[model samples]
Target: MIRQPFKARTPEELISLLSAVAMAILAAIIVMVLYYGREIIIPIALAVLLSFVLAPLVRLVQRLRIPRSLAVVSVVVIAFAFIFAMGSLLATQLAQLAGDLPRYQSTISEKIQSFRETTAGRGTLERASSMLKDLSKELDKPKEAANSLGTIAAPKAASPKPVPVEVLQPDPGALESLQTLISPLLHPLATTGIIVIFVIFILLQREDLRNRLIRLAGSDDLQRTTAALDDAASRLSRLFLIQLLLNGSFGIIIGMGLWLIGVPSAILWGILAAVLRFVPYIGAVIAAAFPLALAVAVDPTWTMLLWTIALFVVVEPVVGHVLEPMVYGHSTGLSPVAVVASATFWTALWGPIGLVLATPLTVCLVVLGRHVERLEFLDVMFGDRPALSPPEIFYQRMLAGDPTEASAKAEEFLKERSLGSYYDEVALRGLQLAQADAERGALAPDRLTKIRDAVQEFANNISEQDERPSPKVNPTTDVEATSAIEGVAEDAPYESLRVLRKEDLPSEWQGDHPVLCLAGRNPIDEAAAIMLAQLTDAHGLSSRVEAAGALSTANIFRLETAGVAIACLVYMDASSPAHMRYSVRRLRRKLPKATIILGCWMKDIDPAALESLREGAKADLAAATLGGALKLCIEATGVDSLGTGAEGQISKITAAS
Candidate 1:
């Protein structure tokens, strides 16, 4: 019998099917986000998330047998205290900076006017806002008339649009005065409330929350959900805590620099350095530019301005690249492309608060994916490096290292099915060349270094270019940067952030420059300050626990003195060629730091690492409570006897009571 003619899917049907799936998913996500946009939304989301990050901490504390309530309180308290102290420090600086607003403004205005006069195309003693306003309205008469008629029925609300942009200015005492008077009242109360409420709620209902989760999910679902929550919370707590520590380092370095330079609000600048660090590429530039502008406004010498720039060159990368990525690695698993896209998407959708929540939200997505399976697609999309078996990886590593055996073993280790056309060609070419060279005895150590270095240079070129804005697109799908991702770079001169520049510079900066000092509620500055101090002290560790329980704060060279103090931050990256050379070039500045002695040991950390650590800490603290986790970090880093046995106490209580 003849078979009936078969019909295939038409192009339209295929398109329609795909389109409907996409739209349905989009609509559902938007509806969910909107439905729970406020109130329990942040908490519920944070609870599920923070739990995963803090799971490790909870496990640690459970080992101590301390009451869960007490453990959480301990973690919360430590986190809050660190944050509060930082806030206060930044507030003091911001107040100081604002207090000097008049001076800062006057100087900036003068500089603007001078530039405007010098360049015919630039400006004419006019503020940017006023200039833009005039230009916008110059040809808008007809449009204005039309707009007004359209709105004639009533009127649009005239509230000031919130814009966080504020120009840098010189201030003699405005910030100090404001801090002395106003901040003491407002800052403490608001900060205190956030701390108290967050801590109490997390501690009190934690068990109930866990039980509710268990009830909502069936056995398998319950186990998976609990595991997911525990993992995310523990990791997140550690990440957040690490972030705080890193940021604090940045603030210290920056503040010291400003202070030594006789800049009025060193503390403020330091804090700015720390908080701005959260914004990635953009933040570092802003932080660097601010202090440089201040230095230029006050100092008559071009040398000092150059010094400021030079210092930034070092500071930005040291904290941004070297320090951050160290402990964190690519652990967040988010690709650079995914990170920037998510940040931009969330910022557009929910503003600054959303920007702060973007990474955490992404983390939540990854965790959720582990449970639902469907969402795991996102985890793969966002991750920097694909996960593989360790033993298989080690075998591949050995194979590649041999060069002679690399060709035949390519698919044997990498997998035949997984290779894309592009990847297949590239791998074959590379391995073939290596194998041939091995046969010819061209695999000398020198040649290996040369090829490796060339690869690195090519990669660095890629990374620098990757910073450009991406093509605009809907936020529904993954947006990745490159197929071959680069390793994190080296950190620069956070030490100079703590350096004293006035003494290092000509007499003009000391006497003739108009010092503009102001302050505001920016936490990044505090971190910069801490970092600056750490750099100068010769020993790079910042945590009290790391420094044998003594708060090591000496010589953390502020900006003024950092040029001479800090030598370099070194690192190693095997994942990408761009990682090594770019980092070395960025951190070392071609001129090496003088070795004062033979006994000094220095280690470099990637700045990305700090944020990861902070996120981990915060998530852990929120989910599992903090006592055990904090103790673990302290003990891990070898902090003085804060009493490690407490973990056992906490764990015993969980089981017995």
Candidate 2:
């Protein structure tokens, strides 16, 4: 027998496979380029970030009537001059600290001796040390015994010990001494020079560079390209500026606190804190280490050390958690995990500088992902925004059999929206998706059953919540709310819906089981009916839900319809309007006096076709959304307080009938 080759089932599958392979290869190539070219790229990346920080300052100078060239030159020089002064001050502080370290040696020794005494006084350490000594003695006993035996057995003359030889080279002259002194400085100095040159050129030619980037990215879509660039620039600039301000303020506070706490070189520690904190997560820890060490050395009593520890513990959290968020306001657009992961990745590729630049670079990637068509996965992966919409999330949770999370999501959405709106916009749409999958034969029976159970569970969880918007809140009348309900038939206009209070509803609708929500065919339809029933019950009208089987010929006669004022037939799959018409006819026969409304959750049906469906089914009205069906039920209650638009729509439909 011969084996057949595997193949993609569709063009889309084949294309997706090829595209994924291409992306993986592209990613590998990019990583290689980044790693191999870091010597050249690192300096340029630093310069670019620096330019973003300094661009505003240059613009400010230009606003003062300075020429562009002069402004660029002045800003670059001033910025670097300030950096140089800070470096010099840091060096001076370091030299002084080093010189003063010898004075603390006695205190350090005393501390060490005290620690040793404390540990020795504790029996645990002493026991471990004594055990090691005994073990060594036992192990050496055999060797010593052998040596004694050899000596007693008239061992040969002791072998002469070889003398040790040492080799030395001549001392270095002035050139070599200078080379030795400057070798460590050469890389940093060269990098600084390259960065300075790059920054100056970038600031001078910023517009030209932006144009080139736009052309390279997408000249045909100038709007998108410009927007992407503008977004990236604005975000990067804001992030850098806010971070600088916040970190600087933090450092100042830390310095003052450390000084009051009697820590040595508080100013130096503060500067280090401000500078090092540009590296995310671990920067504050590194910055605190120096001051903590000095605190321990400067004060033998441990008071200063404890104070320094407390200072960082309290101050860093306040700055990072409180101040940064308040100031940043989603400026970075990077998730916390993305920030850390990008830091690790870039640090691997470009070392420490990459750690500092990770967030800004990832921000550019996110902005590009948001604006560019092909790179959207980057935003989905790294951006702080939710990757999936509410309906998709709800559907996915149902698929995962997580009713709790689905209910939680519904509750969260309900905080700002009525439960009816949530059902129309989120839950019903999610069920529609399930219906689509089921129609496509993609959903297994057991999986469908799980989804049904999950939906039912979710409905039960939030059933008690009021369906009306809070009195203090103004209800949303946005077109989006209506359009979400209408699904794909956006051209069909919908009337504004309002859930009426129980007292506001007519006397007939105030009775028990005024509305009967019957599932059209499947469990998905049943789930949708459950939503409608919840909505109707939440509003003033009493409602009950029955399965599709309950509406079968055998069970139809058994269903109690004495108090049912309205019968809402729900069909998640409305492709076969014949079946819906049949169901509607059956319900009409059972409840001849009750108003019949068809709730078609289908996405593709148009208004004309829906009206045709309603008329052919011999139903009084039809709606594509839960909200619409609920509104129809409310209007059926003979309430006149509905908005004029709603009343007009009801009148038009009634007259047409």
Candidate 3:
């Protein structure tokens, strides 16, 4: 008989798998409820999210030796103050918006009519007219038939005395039934009260509560459970806080911008944006529509509507793309796929409230998976991706930078699970915009620092973050001896390229596998999925797209969420194409084993110039072997050899960009 090595599951392993599956099912149900009853879901979810937000402050007050009841009172007062401020602003905006509605609608109608007159416009208008005509015909038939009935009824009423009012009334029991219908609402209110009290007590006696919980888990596993719960609480709290700040900022920016534009209900729109940001994809679309409808109703001009669209275009991106990262770089560690899945699932079960709770709930599930055995798979699938772990990520990058492997590590995150919340639709848009810029080669290197800096800022409170030490170099080193004296030469940019040495390549990259690193305006997120299907396990072609995901722009979000890494760092050189530079720099720095390839708009390229650049980077500047040519190109992009260009020009592109 052959002896086989056996593997034993630990306590944490046992908990992870089972907990994941159970939580996933719960999340699914919650999503279904949210989808079916959005209006009801919103307030409930808002209250729950708010509970988390206020819980901390309540606890802080309690910690100061105040009574828990008093702390609850203090939290309530703060909530009222906040609500009043928001309500007042919202009221003013609504009033103004209402007054301006007719004008905006007329303006939009006029634009539509104008558009109809143009050649392309005419076809679109005709189709729309045909559709509208059909709808009107259908609608008018019912109205006309109903009106005929009304005429016939007039004779009957005249012919016979109307039934006595008392006779028409339903039985007394029916009235009681009507009252019963509202009983459900009353019960929810009672439940809400209980939840509030529960939350406050939990917050106030947090320390004692934790101690009790630790004891309950048993001495053998007490430390582990306590740590897991604490981690969950801390991370959950941090995420909610970051989300709140980001939402508020978006609202303020949108509101102020509308006001400055002289658009009606500017304040209301801003407040609306803020509130709607909490909703997923649907929220931004809705928020934009309200403004668009108002813009059209007020001006009834194509130009005015166009201006409104432009305003949203300019404002939404800055707020979502720029300010969003700056404010809420908190990584909940869920993959984009998992996030969407959870959001969808919870929305199905619990409605919008479920959506809001999805993320936190998922985090709790991940915690539970750490305890239970059956749900361990979920922890692996949905937990913060192993790719994000600096050590593992560093090791992979070191192993001859296999983007496929990097993608795999990132995919590992998908196993961790999620609770879907539409906390930042604007953030998603910003990410899309960044990807578009990356495709166009319009991105500037300076933007990445702004982006990364913003990421760092947004994710400031995250645990286990490495503290970077100020760099200290040896004075006696050959490269440092002369260059160190001049800070400019010695100042190493975090971005890469301008040089490609053997050491810069990793063990995985140094092999026989052919590699293609594609980047463009329409950056595909499914590369890993596609690559995974095509490659063998030995190939190591997996989810690891690069070393860093969100490099210089929120556009990198698709890649970030997909578990893509940035291969290299780039300097802001506007004269150089931003997209190409970013792509090349990334491949140069991040992927040591793989060669970087550029994805470009076919029309935009000057074939002759492209050939020159291609040849310059390769052997004979014209060699045909994929690996050799790629190596040549890497050599050409090496720093020091490529002279610098106008950085201010690059800065402008990023700023207005």
lDDT values for all models: 0.45, 0.78, 0.48
Candidate 2's residue-wise lDDT over 1-657, tens digit each? 999998647989889999999989999999999999998889898898899899888989999999999999999999999889988888898888889999999998999889888888577878898899999999999999999998899968989999999999998999999999999999989999999999999999988998887776765778768876887777777778778888889889998999899777778998989887877788899899999988878898888888889999999988888777787663367788998899899888888778777877887789778876667899999999999888889999999999898877777766665566677778877887899899999998889878878888887888755433243332233334222123232222223444455676666676778899998888888888888887666555788999877878788789988778898888887577778777777787888888888877787577777777777777777888776776667667777424333322211110000
Q: Lowest-scoring 10 consecutive residues by lDDT in candidate 1? A: 648-657
Question: What does the lDDT come to for candidate 3?
Answer: 0.48
CA lDDT of 246 in candidate 2?
85
Which residue pairs clash within candidate 2? none
How well does candidate 1 score on lDDT at residue 250?
80
State the TM-score for model 3. Answer: 0.46
TM-score of 1: 0.44
Ranking by TM-score: 2, 3, 1
lDDT (Cα, tens digit) per residue for candidate 1, span 1-657: 999899999999999999999989997898578445734355455444444444456557767988877776676667568767878877787787777766766666777667677865554535675788998887898898888898986777799979899889877598888887977687656645654665457555766766675565444666667776666555666876576578778878877876776666777777877776666557677777888877777664456677767766887678667877886753465777877887787676666655666776776666555544556667776656555433233223433443223323333432321111111233323423443454467566555444433332322222221111112212233222221111121111111111123343333223321111110011111111222222222111222101110111231122122223222221111222243233233223322442110000011223344333324222111101111111222222222311123221011000010
Give the worst 10-residue stretch by lDDT in candidate 3: 648-657
Best of the candidates, TM-score:
2
Collision count for each candidate, in order: 168, 0, 105
**Which candidate number has the best lDDT?**
2
